[model samples]
Target: MELDILAEKENVICEMVSNLYRTKSNDDSEIFTSIYNQYKSIHLQYSELSKNNLEALKRGLFIQWYQKTEPNFLSGISDLEQDAEKQIVNNLFTVINTKQVDSELIWMLNYYNSWDWVFLNYENFRRFDTNLVNEANNRLPENIDKKLMLKRGQMGKYWLSLIKYGSTE
Candidate 1:
């Protein structure tokens, strides 16, 4: 019974994580926010597991989730601090520096480098007091391509996240 419960919790966490990536890929901020909150709640439930399982499972989340088959736009989903985990962070830094990223991640890195564009409002322009970016009536730009811009506008957020969490936030 205990094993079954533990397995179920693991499955729930896995599904929640998949949902997070899906929402992020789709650029669905509303749904992503909802899933993010729910994941936090479900992860907290892992404490009910026996033994040192919670810490072990956290390691798995970082290893399988952040360091694997797909691009990890969700890099900071956990916190990686131990010496062994630092190796993973170093690997990512090397990949970024050497331009040797996996093909799947290349597009995301390109989009992020593009820095994307913004949709501002009258209040925003007034706040910045710059006529540089005029209001677009709170509408997306005509050339907006969400399909090609999944992580475009998140540079600062991710940069700070990588700095603080070291790629497993």
Candidate 2:
């Protein structure tokens, strides 16, 4: 009888943990066996106990759940992280293809590299006041606007592409 009760309790704990990742919050008791208040109290007890007795309860929340649950929850989380990283890498490749030598691309490159282009000239323009920019803007001719815009745009894209995809050929 005792063994049966322990098995049932273990099953309940496993179910609660499996549902934890699906639930909106860790405090939600819908996945737990006991009443909400009781579950909350026990949760608090566990948290406090873990904090006070670090040597015994040093394992993190995910580690604790993985240890108790029959399923490999750790692998699931790991796979999710890996898949997200892969998607980011794919998007990075798409950005790399944006650089080209067409007229429009040349214009973009010029716009980005201009001194007046804030993003492209961030190294020089960052922390500079609006007054300084306005002074520079007033002094510069209108045709230079296109050059600044294109230069800034190109430089911004170049640096961003470099950071995300590294030096591309």
Taking the tens digit of each residue's C-alpha lDDT, what string does model 2 give over 49-86?
A: 43333211211222222222323331121111222233
**Tens-digit per-residue lDDT, 11-125, candidate 1:** 4544565667666566655654554444343333332221234232332323323323334335323322233343333443444455554433443333322322211211222
What value does the lDDT take at residue 14 in candidate 1? 49
Q: How badly does each model clash, as a count of residue pairs?
A: 4, 15
* Candidate 1 total steric clashes: 4
Q: Every model's Cα RMSD, please? A: 17.2, 23.3
Ten-residue region with minimum lDDT total, candidate 2:
74-83
Candidate 2, after superposition: displacement of residue 122 in Å?
57
Q: Pick the candidate with the highest lDDT.
A: 1
Error of 2 at 23 (Å): 2.7
